[model samples]
Target: MPLPEKEAWPALIALCIGFFMILLDQTIVAVSTPALQTDMGASYNEVIWVTSVYLLTFAVPLLVTGRLGDKYGPKKVYAVGMIVFTLSSLACGLAPDMLTLIIARGVQGLGAALLTPQTMATINRIFSFERRGAALGVWGSTAGLASLAGPILGGIITENWGWQWVFYINVPIGVICVLAVLKYVPNFPPHTRPLDPLSIILSVCAVFFLVFAFQEGEDAGWAPWIWIMMAGSVVLFAWFVYQQRRAERAGNDPLVPLAIFRIKNFSLGNICIVAMGFTVAGTPLPIMMYFQQVHDMNPMHAGLMMVPQALMAFVLSPYVGKLVDRSKPGKLAAAGFATTSVSIVLLAITMMFDLGLVSALVAMTLLGIGNSFVWAPNSTSTMRDLPHQYMGAGSGVFNTTRQLGSVIGAAAIGAVMQVRLSAGDPGHAFGQALLLAAAVLLVGVVASMMADDGTRDPS
Candidate 1:
């Protein structure tokens, strides 16, 4: 049964709580990196793994988790994921050492993987097609707001209470989400389908190697083993793709539907989202470090720097959502990418040149504005045209690319900073790292430009 208008909003609100928490964890650790390093007596590489491992676990299982939503009921899977997340969060808050925290975070990521797809898939199932753009706009905006808000919130919590509170805070939010979901969110009929284990193994191994190679490359002196691992990741991923095609043809339920890529907007949107993910994930660590470590700002002050970007996104997302339904999403996305890339470039220049806090604030404000344009339009355009049968699969693929971009960004930026740190200038090293994210955003610009721009009427 389709959800009535009155019921849908409540359900979406309930779902967004869980969704927000998932995205929140993605970058929340950024502001706490220094704290974690000091408290746990860990090196930079190990501290970076705290974020990377979460992203790695989160990304690898997403393809299957979406299928789990299709096979089981979304509601059941979502509820279970929430339980896992809440408990792991508790474990994270109490961890005795860095290794324990990283392990707990990996479990937390698994819960995130299970929870993410159901929100999108449920929104698709419940809302009428005419209203999906607006619903998804709200969804997309929640994603943007959560991601951008992470550093701000993390700083505040870490500074006042302790870094442990960052994870501890999720406990209450998770409990509320699980309860609300059980009360408000309805379960759709399940599609009983078989999953391929080989494909799952291949994908997990492929991503693990690729990210691991990047994470360790600089410290390992770009060793032959790193290059070999990189090559092996490519081979494994290529094999995984080949197997997916064969599975689809053989009537064995494939992890991702290859036919979905034929939707030009969907494919292009995925590419753009990858860049979006990459930039968002890649920038936070270096930027946060610059503010606190180099500039001698307290954690609270460092977090306050993100306020402009968060405010702009919060204020502008509703209007952008409307625009996405009424205007050319492709153009909006292109403009957004161009604007974001410029903002990052400005930030990089400011840091590299010691241009001061005012310049950085201006860049952050611009970044928020740019985010408001990208998140809603890109997500709406990408999934709006997908067939109902592929809704779960489509959501899975979309999120996978987004998170995969994050994983890559996290590793690549860390590596870049590690290498550049040898130059003996903290500002220069971090600023150079920011440029990589800026460069990647331009790919989003080009992808958005090439995308189909046909607007769909709300009626």
Candidate 2:
């Protein structure tokens, strides 16, 4: 049965809460890293793992979870994930050592992997196309707001209460979300074929090796092991492709349909999405460190500084979504990328000059606007052309690439910063990193330009 209008809103609210919780965890731990190190007596590498392990698990399982949601039901998968995440949060709060904390974080990532893509799929399933853009705008804005809030909230908790409160706080909010979902979220079972366990294992292995190489390569120093893992990743990915082709030939349901890429807009749009993820994911960590550690800004002040960007994104995304419904997405995406590139260049310059708070805020505001323009519209355009049959797989693939981009961004940017700091010029090192991010964004613009304008759905 189609949900009543009143019922739909609560379902969306539950989904958004889950979405906010997952995104908030990504950065909240960042500001608390120093505190964690101090409290746990951790080495630098161990401290970094507190964040990296979560991201690692989060990225790897997204494809699997996305498919699971489609095969079972988004509501079931999402509710289970929420319960696991809430429990894991409590575990994280009570963790006795770095090892325990890192393990709990990995479990949290598993829960997040289960939760994240369902948000998009549910929004897509429930809302009409005409209204999906707006729904997505709200969804995108929530994530941006969470990211913006994390550092400040984390800082305050770390300062007054304790870093443990960061995880502890999730318990009550998560309980409310669970209750809301159980009461309001409707279950929709799969109308598709059975799941492919072999494909799932192969794909997971492929992504794991690839991300593991990237995550550990710089730290382990271009060693033979890293090279072997990288090579192994490539081969495993090729095998995955071959297996999918085999499944298609055999008329079996592959975990991911190869034919989805036949949709020209989706294929190219995912490339741009990955690039967008790289740009946003790579910039924040070092920038946060620069603000708090180098410049001596308080956590609240640093978090508040990000407000302009988050606020601008929250304000502009809905309008951009409206524009996506009426306009050619390529031009908008290209324009957004161009604006983002310029903002990154301006950020790099400002950082190089060691600019003050107001100037930095202006730079961030520009970045936020640019980000808002591309983020939702790109997603809408990519999925717009897809038939509803493939929404699950397509959403999975899109999110997978996005998460992959974030993983690469974090590893690459972190490696650069690590290398540069070792050379005794951390400030200039970050400036160079921003320059690289700008170049990446420019590539995203090119990809956006190449996207299929003709495929856009003219509602």
Candidate 3:
């Protein structure tokens, strides 16, 4: 039966609110890193891990969380996640030492992993086909807005109040979301499937080792241990693939079905998503750091600097979403990548010349517009043709890939900055890093062109 329109909207809003909290935390913590360092007396590398650890936990669990939501219920899992996230935020705010804060951040990431996948899954279940695009457009915009707002909000809180408030702010919002979920969201029972414990263990180990290696490798001087971890990751991944295939052939439930990749468009679109993730997610923090630390801009000013990008994305996303619904999403995505590449090049030039605020604003606006086009269409295209039953698992895998890309992007960009700055050319190194990100987006353009048009089954 179709949901009553009023009934669905509340739940959707609740889910988006929860999502906003998660997205907000990503950039908010970034802008406040300096404040955190001073307050906690943390080392530069330790400060970086404050952000990295959250992402690491968040990225790895997405695959399983989505499937868990499907097998259980999105409402139950999502609400539980919110409660945990809210409590964790409190713990983070009250943390007395760096170790406590890091652990709290990790807990928050775990909550986020549980919460995020269910938002899309819930939207898919409630919204009709005709409205899905519009709904997703709103969803996409919320994320963009949060991304834009996080830095500024973080800056404001840190500058005026203190860094602790960054975590504390989530409390009220989290409470509201939790109450809203309890009041409106409906719960459904689980789908009967055997849990793939081995697959889960192997996948988690592989991702943890791989991400840890990448994140610490540069700072740790690419030690022998890092290489060992990387090699272990590869072997574990191979074992996971083999295990999943075995499970599938034996007529048992696998954690992730290997056959999902058989669909050329889905596979190809995911590559674009991963590349897009790398290009955007990782670039912002280092750029923000450069603006604040090197340029000596205050937190508020640095945050305000990003306003143009946020505004552009907010204004353009609805139109872009509509375009994707009616036209070829791949073409739109390709155009987005092209625009992004051009914008990055412009940014590189601006950095080389030490451009003023106006120039930087224009560059960021262009980047934002490009981002709106890429994010909405790429997401829509990736999931467009999947069977309804697979939406949960698909959403999980899709988000997991994106998060993994984010982790890799952060590490890669950070390493580049570290190398370049150490060599006494911070500006030049930043430009090189931007160029590398642009190259990644250009590759996304190629992958987007190859994505399926949803004319065939995704599975």
Candidate 4:
């Protein structure tokens, strides 16, 4: 029984409430890190763990959690995750010490991991094919808008209500989201097949090692242990792949179906998102720093500079989503990537030349426009043709790549900033870093060009 579009919208709104919070937390804590250190009297390394630990826990369990959504119903899994995230957010608010806060954040990350894939998986199952792009466009907009709002909200909340409120804010949102989901979201049947424990183990360990290496590599100065972890992750991942192949040969379902990659759009979509994650996570810090460090803006003022970017993305996403259903998604996505790349170049120029805030605002407006074109189209094209049985796994793989891209982007951009800052003025250093982000978007452009049109016959 396919859900009616009216009902599906409510479910999607419910799912996106949690979705928005998950992404918001990912970046919300960035501006609060310094405040945390001061209040808790924690060392710089300890404060860094506040964010790093969350990413570590969040990135590691995605494969398992995605499968869990398939095994138990997504509704049940989502409810559990909401409870965990809400409780952990409370714990985070009340923590008397940095250690407790870090632990709580890790639990929150685990909760985030559990909630993420089910949204996409559920949408795929619920919506008729013809309208999926519009649904996803809304989802994509939620994702992009939440990210842009994080720093702004963090700055406002941390300054006015204190840093703890950042965590406290999620409690109400989480509660409402959970109730809405249980009421509106359909109870989709679970896949009752037993999961292979070894596959779960290998996937978890492999992702943990890989994510941790990148998360801490720059901080650890690329030490031998980091390199060892990276190598070990590769080897374990290879073994996991081999195991999945063996499972397929034995007629058993694997954690991630090996066949999903055969879909050209799916493969290309993963490639494009990795680049998108890299650009989204990597580009912001330098520009934010340029605003604060070079122009002497406060955190609030610096965060406010992103208004044009957020506004454009929010305004244009729905229309662009309609276009995805009507046009070649690949071409649309490629145009988006190109537009974003050009915007980054413009931002870089604005920074390097000290071209003032007007030009920078112009660049951001273009960026928002580019983002509007990318998310809905790229995601719709990627998963539109995926099989029902594989929806959870596909969503998991899709999300995993995006998160991995974030980890990679954060590490890479940090390194670039470090090297550039040491060699030149803040303007030049930040400008060069923006250039790297611009360069990475070109890869997305190339990948998007290879995607399918994403059109499907009416169900």
In terms of TM-score, the best-performing candidate is: 4
Per-residue lDDT of model 3, residues 1-459, tens digit only:
335778887878888999988999988887788888998999987887788889888887787888888888888899889989999999999999999999999999999999898988877777665455566777878878897788778878988989999999999999999999888888766778775888888888988888888878877898999999999999998999899988777766788777667756667778888888898776876667657776898767877878887888878887887776677777888899889888988887777577866777789999988988887787777776666666778788888788778778877887877777778766677767777788888888898888766554322
Could you tell me the lDDT of residue 438 within candidate 2? Answer: 86
| TM-score of candidate 1 versus the correct structure, residues matched by position | 0.91
Candidate 3, residue 357: CA error in Å? 3.3
Best by lDDT: 4
**How much lDDT does each candidate structure score?**
0.85, 0.82, 0.82, 0.89
Clashing pairs in 2: none
lDDT of 1 by residue, 299-336 (tens): 67777788888888877887887777678788898999
Candidate 2 residues 1-459, lDDT tens each?
335557776788888998898888777877787888898899998887888788888888888888888888888888899999999999999999989999999999899888887888777777666666766777778877887778778888889988898999889988998888888888786757776677899999989998888888888887999989889989988988888888777766788888888888889888998888888788886777778776897767777778888889878887887787677777888999999989888877777777776777888999889988897778877887776667777788888999888778877887887777788755677767787788888877888888876663322
Whole-model lDDT, model 2: 0.82
Q: Which stretches of model 3 miss by more than 4 angstroms?
A: 1-5, 454-459
lDDT of 2 at 161: 88
Model 2 misses residue 83 by how many Å? 1.1
Runs in model 2 with CA error above 4 Å? 1-7, 419-425, 454-459
Q: Which candidate, 1 or 3, has the higher TM-score? A: 3
